[model samples]
Target chain A: MIQRSQLDLRKFVAPEFICGHGALQLAGRYARNFGMRHVLLVTDPGVRAAGWTDAVGESLTEAGISFTIFDAISVNPRSRQVMSGTEVYRAEECNGIVAVGGGSPMDCAKGIGIASSNMRDILAFEGVDRVPVPAPPLICIPTTAGSSADVSQFAIITDDVRKRKIAIISKTLVPDISLLDPEPLTTMSPELTVDTGMDALSHAIEAYVSNASSPMTDVHALEAIRLISSALPAAVREPHNLDLRFSTLLGSLHAGLAFSNASLGAVHAMAHSLGAACDLAHGRCNAMLLEHVIAANYEAAPDRYDQVGAILGAAEGGRGTPAENVAAFRRSLGVTETLAAVGVREDAIRTLARQAYADPCMVTNPRRLTCEDLERIYAYAL
Target chain B: MHMHSDPPDDRDALREKIIGLGETSLHKSYYPELQSRLAELERFRALLDQTHDAIFLIRADTGRLADVNASAVTYLGLSKEELLAMPFASLIAPHQKAAFLETVRKSNEVPSGSRRTCTAYLVSREGREIPMEITVRSVIFGDEQYIVAIARDITDRILTEEELKIKESALESSTNGILIADLTGAIMYANPGFASIFGYEQDGVFMGKNLEAFFATPSVGEEITGHLLDNHTIVKETIGLRSDGSSFHIQVSGSVVQNDAGEPLCIMLIVMDITERILTDQMKRKTYEQLGKNIEQFAIIGDHIRNPLQVIVGYVEMIDDPLAEKILEQSCRINEFVTQLDRGWVESANVRQFLRKHGDGGEPPLQTFIHIGATKEEDP
Candidate 1:
């Protein structure tokens, strides 16, 4: 018998918005406002092949902004690749940037933007808000439906020296504009669709249970959970389902807005280090590690997990024992299987446990865990 | 009357006894007073002679034959006999004699606590002029007004002041932009070079502008302000915006200026314009980029031309007898042209030597400096 009360929610809106279906169409307009004449368009080979690069280039050309295309960005962008991108940005006299594609391209773009303006080595800027300069006017056009890097104020660049992922999170690095177009995402394979959709779900669910979770973030997180759970399977089954594609795209957007403000939990912290060290997909790592991390967080804030479980159709009438709620949520997300199915090794548990404890995101974990507790969690998941 | 007269004689006797006692007291005080006074005058003379300050005594009636202490001889570079024999006015340098006489006369007229001082030239034994501070104090001695003159030489202090002025002037005219401001960032002084670096007039004074006025970007202002408040000095490179909105780069060294008591008084800004260096750097970067493009284009051309040249060489090697001679000659010309182009673009000292001394190595090396021509000396 939960009574519904009028709760005051605080919302943080962008001072200005550069949004819409083909919002990338305004790249040149925004660039001009920043007094930029030359621009850099950073994207990956896949996005270039899919014609998103041409679309963005056409927009810039229309705005009378001359630009050079850097299609050398790789997935899970390496330090060398970002350095090369920075060189390209400098060589081209680019004063503005347009990042087109998934999290990989946008992340690489953020790295190039920081390194080019600040003149800092890529390896030196990892794990926090180390970048001090405002990046050039950047427009992010996310072509993938899953990675919400378009609207999120976060970027992950690989640190080649340490062989780890360096997460650069700063309001300075946030793109001045995010151009979301569901049309490009229609061409993704079912596997990519499933993986990205699951990533969005992970974002929403993690935000819901985060220690810094607020009513404002909770609304978006719950909406994101509902949209992803309903439309992800449909998107995976039918890549061109426009309705389902819109839902997944919007879901990713909501999750981005939610998690960006509220921050994430231990899942992202551990997933990032593992993905960087092991060269695994970001979404795949999150998917494989999701259940164990949720179970661990449930002990810290059962009510919070219960709210998440209820949002995902796991909690019965939105009320249940903590274990039952989490178990039901695990079953609903189809992540109940052993971590072994996802190619994670039991032998690597100790190393992964230590890394998870050292992660930056662990600072915000509701219940702090010892190294031994981390080991037990990994073993259980394995 | 006779009886009253006898009574009056008793009164006269009492009066005589009183007079006798009074005389005895006066007699006893006189010797001690006179002896102490003589000792006091002797001690005063000895103290005046030992002191470093020159002391002079001027007679009001003649203004000549004045007495001076022993320090006056060394101070005025004069002999004791000459100082005693010379009128005080004669000892004063001709340029200062009139002013000295007027002051001495004024002090005499107002003998009670009259005092005056002036920097004047005093003549020495060899007629050399020594600058000295002459102070006159009027005093009444033996019912006559006498002037006491104390003289001090300040040549060393004056010379040090002149040196400081020269150094300060040199610093003001320096090419390095230097600025000093109060603790509140109010500009106290700006060197000519500092104003000119920002394209301002040498006399274009800035009194109250904050340090933030120099930077175009807010972040730089914030960073510099924080560093200045914390460390008292900061050396950084940033873009400086001119009043005209055009920006230039500078290397600024800022430090806290302190007062005599070591309290912070102001900030000092030393600016070095690095705009030219940044421009040169940008030009060098552009040159490198152009070079890279040119290299890529040249490589493409090399590949295109070398492929056909290889075919020609292959066909020529396949030829035999009479046609072989024509084909071989043409092949050699083509090979020579290719080598010429290679040498133009590439220079490998070791590879060229190896190629000249020995035939091509069997294995292709990982790194190749592909020369397109023969050596410069070998070329026609």
Candidate 2:
């Protein structure tokens, strides 16, 4: 490991972003500036029913940009949906894309753009730097506070044939513009709010303690942890409060920018397998798995974990470690669900362990993990 | 610890709760909006049909044509109804139909919007074979899967490409030195003939060199550029410098090449080595001039000798002595020999034939006597 003073090289990448109460209205204007004559507007049915999709469409029409709707994307978006979206994009002659939902719609949009531009199946692009071309101009208006697909360089797409979520990481997948508006966050249920908020917390903590972390990512990760710790409970309790929603949105955005450059650790790697195999909410999986990963990795980076513990309101030099403090925080949010509680079978632990061990995120984990070690961790989580 | 075993009653309660949640979450029904937003798509049909390339939509499951554009109808030489009723495989050549169907199957298996291109021959209604480039894309519309093919005739394009290849081959094999240089005199291309003429083993060694480097003087390149700028194509003989720094006579014919916009792009120069021809011409001219001078000198010498000989002959005849008569006879014979020498020299006659006609077949020959200015040593 290079000491901070001896570190000589670092690179950071982030998308052009805006965060405010009604920045979602700027999606169409940004699309026009990107030279979009016609666009494919990707969203899920839930976001469509929440009225954000219609609002985004009105903005596009007012800006004199024609668009087509592709709302067939589902949670844990399948590769088939991405291909179908690409077909619609070509049929409509869309010059750009506007995604108006959570991670599923945005990831589906990214997959569509990648497949269309590269002229290959979406599954062909898995892992880092595999996408050969930049996606068409994409403007994202994220409705959920977590899963910052609006500004992230990551696209998690599920391969229905393989029954696993493949993470495609490339700077080209970063949206051309991100329009974050807290108005849409009011529609999320309290359970969803807690789950997604905890996902953001996992993103911050894991990025801060990752082997690839640097000073540039450290600041954003810590700031995200501070904001999520302070504002997530309030936002979950009072869903309609715009201020708390904005804070959580900013926190998620910072966490995304941090992990995008610094990368994540075992928490994300393990959560991906669980999310894909069980078809569960991704944030809930990450929340359930974050504390255990930290417990396993705290010995490798004690100072960074201690800082995270302090941010979560643990006393300085306290008897409890940061991993315990984070667990306490998860309990306070009422998200203490075990793997068995979520209907995961003990027989599947070995398979999930092997998949998580092979995930790309495992490479950046602070402590090296073997397949056996991952299986043990899964048992511990159970 | 004598505790009574309690039955696991919570399993049924938990199962009921999960089933309730799953029922509420899993139920989905499609509701089509009554809005008239997607009506703009009707224009796509006309646009697709208006294209020059043939477009056909085939059902993936049946491998039959579901729809075809006007261009497809015209290209296939069949009516729209007939074309749509025919199987897509019937239009493909019999030998290529299997491969085409396999490609269509693979396209169906791949994700929608993935495309594949193939070069195949399409059989027309009259059994005429037309080479075609076909692009097939998988599409899903209204719950049905289709393979849309756009085919273009590539006969003219292939012919043009072949013609270009022939021309390029001819240029490469030409014996005359050929060079193409930019306006700034930098050599862009040099053929093998140019390399050999310039004493290089390969054309690549001469590329990017200045055109002036191959000229005996830099001013020659400038003069050629000046003529080219005036749109004057010229052929001129000039000195050429070889790679070894030896100079030789060369004939250069140069013209300016231009683009469709009428802007000059480069200068094309054809060079021919004319050193041997120039040397032969110079030798012939020198021989002719020397023969003329020799004839003029011979005439002058003959006139001077005859004038003196006549004076001597006249004086000897006046004296009327035997020896003096002999002298007069000999002088007359000498004068005859000199006159014969002048008259016998014909430009067209072979020297050996002239010798045989004039010389004796003995120790002393007639041509030898003429050279000594004596016919006989004189009966005196």
Q: For model 2 chain B, give the 10-residue run with minimal summed lDDT.
A: B26-35
- The 10-residue segment with the lowest total lDDT in model 2 chain A: A1-10
lDDT for position A336 in model 2: 85
Write down the RMSD of candidate 2 (Cα, Å). 26.9
lDDT of 2 by residue, A289-380 (tens): 88888888878888889889988864223446787888888888898889999998889999999999989999989889889888888888
Clashing pairs in 2: none
Residue A353, model 2: lDDT of 94
**In angstroms, how far off is B227's CA in candidate 1?**
76
Worst 10 residues of 1 chain B by lDDT: B21-30
**Candidate 1 chain A TM-score vs. reference chain A:** 0.89
lDDT per residue for candidate 1 within B201-301, as digits (tens), equals: 65356666666676777466557656776798999989887767778899989887677997877677788898887776666556444554565566668
- Badly placed stretches (over 4 Å) of model 2 are A1-6, A314-319, B1-380
